[model samples]
Target: MEIKLVPVRPEDKGTLINLYQLYEHDFSRFTNRDIDKNGRYEVNIDFYWEGDERWNPFYIEVSGTIAGFLVVLFENMDIDPDPTHVIYDFMILQKYRRTGIGRAAAIKAFKMYNADWAVTQMENNTPAISFWRNVIKSFKEDNFTERYRPERKKYIQELSTKT
Candidate 1:
């Protein structure tokens, strides 16, 4: 299956915003975040695109169709001097599940960033935990670390590219 991550552009904002709603819809099952009675979930999309140079968001495309989106940002969640690129949000359309598209997109992101990387899944999301564990395991095993951070209640996978 062909998969790609396209940098979301201004003209695509409307489409991305619409997809963001679905992302939140799926996340609700694993978190306490509330959706408004009107069925809207709050997010800072504009800020994500404008306010921070370190924040990057991409649209996941499967064979020329928008499948989902993910945010890869240079953040200090675990704090390392070498800089850390984190995959903050990842969503794949239900129609595209279990087809290796997510894996291909993630592997592309790893090569594109080519730095210390972090991917975290909320502890309650078992499917996510399993998916990420398998993905990390396929990479260079010597450079990866997987563990649950009790304070944040998140399962974290960190990849250190250092020799």
Candidate 2:
């Protein structure tokens, strides 16, 4: 289970888009997301291509296989104002679920930044909530805050590695 987070290149945008479809499909269960007439869900990976230093995209590879993807967002990046590295998107294929690959990738992503972190999950997504809680707790013990944001309808876990 050698997990590596490879920085996604501009030429790999298509791969990211394809992987995003899967991520969105899985997320649709909790968000009730609907696809357009084209039979494809609209996802915004545009920010990753905006040449911003804050938006990072990575391909989660396990033993040279593309297992999933992760996007880390730095605060002050146009889309979000939170003062922390945000876990914008993360997904592991069905075959890789519950196998620790995702947890490993997530922890790797967190270690890439030495600042605070914010991991959010749709309010109805219990599995995501559990996954993030376990990962953050194992990474930083009980030094994080978990709160629900009514306006956004999501549960956000905020933690700091600086202290």
Candidate 3:
């Protein structure tokens, strides 16, 4: 399958909503809690499109369908107090995963940014943790650290390796 990264537009709001729902649903399955309220979720998504400086959302198109979404957030590092970009969220539809699409999209995003990038996955989401571990392992410099958040019961994996 061909993967394309496209700039998200206002017209793509519905598609973005669907993608967000997919994430919320999967996340709920792992955490056993609803992270989003019905109407409130849409509001948050709309806010992102309404010029949220922190988040830059993009559409991941596979073939002709909008398979998922990715958000690159400009954030300050907790350890070093330096500005950096983080892959805030990334999700591909269940049917479209494990076909190299996710890795391809990641590589594309890395090339486009040409800087240190980071991604965090929930600890219960073993597949995602494993996927990220493999990706980091393949790199020459796996500059990453995992921090456990007792309050959230999740491990935040931060990667700064970019080749």
Model 1 clash tally, residue pairs: 0
Best by lDDT: 2
Candidates' RMSD to native: 2.4, 2.3, 3.6
CA RMSD (A), model 3 = 3.6
* TM-score preference between candidates 1 and 3, better one: 1
Encode model 3's per-residue lDDT on 44-95: one tens digit a residue: 5776666666677888888867777788877754354455788888888898
Off by over 4 Å in 2: 77-83
Per-residue error at 131 for model 1, in Å?
0.4
Q: Write the per-residue lDDT of candidate 1 for residues 1-163, one digit (tens) a residue.
A: 5788999886778888899889988888887789888878986678776756677889999889998888888886336555788998899999888988888888888888658888998888999999988877887666688888899999889886544
What are the runs in model 1 whose C-alpha is more than 4 Å off?
76-81, 161-163
The per-model lDDT (C-alpha) reads 0.83, 0.89, 0.72
Candidate 3 lDDT at 160 equals 61
Query: Which of 2 and 3 is the better model by lDDT?
Result: 2
**Which residue pairs in candidate 1 have backbone atoms (N, alpha carbon, C) closer than 3 angstroms, thus clashing?**
none
**lDDT string, candidate 2, 1-163, tens digits:** 6899999998899889999899889988887989989999997677687777888899999999999999887878566554578998898999999999999999998887778889999888999999999999998899899999999999999988663
